[model samples]
Target: MTTHLITGAGSGIGAVLAQRLLERGDDLVLLARSASRAAELAASYDGARTVVADLADPASVEGLDLPASLDSVVHAAGVVELGAVADLGVASWLEQLTVNLVAPAALTRVALPALRAARGTVVLVNSGAGLTAHPQWSAYAASKHGLKALADSLRTEEAEHGVRVSTVYPGRTATAMQEKVHAQEGKDYDAADWIDPGTVAATILHLLDVPRDATVPDITVRPNA
Candidate 1:
């Protein structure tokens, strides 16, 4: 059975992706921030395994217990706080950077062996902010940009091992994150105006379904409307 370890499976795109994978009868392992979250995920996705690690503290990701082998590791969990460069506090920057960048790196480093054993794929669910930075998004964008760099470098380093790396940049998805972003922007949010979480999740599923003979390096998804 193909096995996948997913972060951010509690909500939004990650949650939708987890459900899709489960519906297909795939072996699923979810990364939870706490024991309570793990229990919730277990109840939500029966037959799925869970590992606890707090992304807010990157150090927590080190030496985490994981499956012996995995077909994919999807880094979908992230945090975002919006404020001007001059207004954003150091703690805010560190929080976003730790949860969005450092923790994923730490977890992926630990999962490399399992990924290599399965010739697995590493999918980083980035943001459009990763590509182009807007005002009040300095910290979050910086972290995402770093995430892109991480994927690019890891792609080259892991290629020889047949491990693939991909980064998906989804724009304004109708997830809780989007709601938060809207609130930060002080704008009204309508789900119909944004991309559906399932759409982004489907694109991720496509990356996983791609033949071994070919690989997708980066994908950027935006709402048509």
Candidate 2:
């Protein structure tokens, strides 16, 4: 069975992806900021293991104990801070970049040896913000854009190791994070206005299903009107 490790498995797209992978008979190692949530998920799944770690902390990521080999590592943990560049505090900006960009890079680096051993795949869950910047979203946009650059660089560098890196850019997925974003925007939260997290999870699964000789490096999933 393929073994996969997923960060942010406590909620949202990460949790949904874990469920999908479990249903498909893959072994999972779930990492989340909430130990209780990760434990609950592991208990529900027959062979899933839980690791509680704050991905924003470099020390926490560097010390992660993982299997010697892994079929995939999905960096689904992220944070967003919305404000015009002039109004956003340096702390908020750094926090957003740390969680949304730096943490993924650090975790991927830690997992590189295991991933290389298995000739595995690395999936970065990015956002449409990575593709375009809008008003009051400067910090978040910059972090995601950095994430896109990270994925692109990793794809090229790891190709020689027979490892594939793919990135999914989803447009406003309906999750707790979307609710937070809507609240910050002073708009009523409407799930209908966003893409479904399951749809994004399905797309990642498709990327993994492709033959080893081929790769779908980048995918964009936008909400339909």
Candidate 3:
């Protein structure tokens, strides 16, 4: 059976991806910010399993109980609080940096041995903001940019071990996070205006389902409007 460990399985693309995998009878280990949150996800995903950790606190990653060998690690948990460089407080900057970038790197480090043993994949769910920065997206973009760098370096370092690293950059997706972004921008959100999270989830699954002989280093998904 295929096994995938995923963060942010509670919602958005991760949630859709988890549901698809579960329906196909794949094994899953999901991350939850707290024990209560873990319970919620357990019930939501039909009691698959979960590990408790706050992505905003990178130190919490050191305690994650990951499987000995697994097929994949999907870093989909992220937070964004849009503010210009001039006004974004240090707390906001730190939280985004820790959750969106630092925590993934730390978690991947601990999962390396298991990944190598299985010659698995590590997929990082990034954003279009990772590629282009607008006026109020400084902190979030910087963290995602750093995440891209992390993946590039890891891809090379782990190549000999046969573990593939891929980063998927999705354009504005209709998720609670996008709604928050619209609220910050003082604009109304219309889910129909954005790409469906399930579409992006399908893209991630394609990368995972491909034949073992080849690997995709990066992919970008954008709305067709």
Which candidate wins on TM-score? 1
lDDT of 1 by residue, 59-157 (tens): 887878888899999999999999999999999999999999999999999999999999999999999999999999999999999999999999999
Residue 205 lDDT (model 3): 96
Instruction: After the best TM-score superposition of candidate 3, give how far the Cα of residue 218 lies from its true spot, in angstroms.
Output: 0.8
Show model 3 residue runs off by greater than 4 Å. none
Instruction: Judge candidate 1 at residue 11 and give its lDDT.
Output: 95
Query: What's the alpha carbon RMSD for model 1?
Result: 0.6
Best by lDDT: 1
**Per-candidate TM vs. native?**
0.99, 0.96, 0.98
**lDDT (Cα, tens digit) per residue for candidate 2, span 1-225:** 899999877778988898999998998998867667767877876789877778668568777888999999998888887998889999999899999988888889999999999999999999999999999999999999999999999999999998999999999999999999999999999897888899999998888788998988899999996
lDDT of each: 0.95, 0.89, 0.93
Candidate 3, residue 176: CA error in Å? 0.2
Per-residue lDDT value at 89 in model 3: 98
Worst 10 residues of 3 by lDDT: 56-65
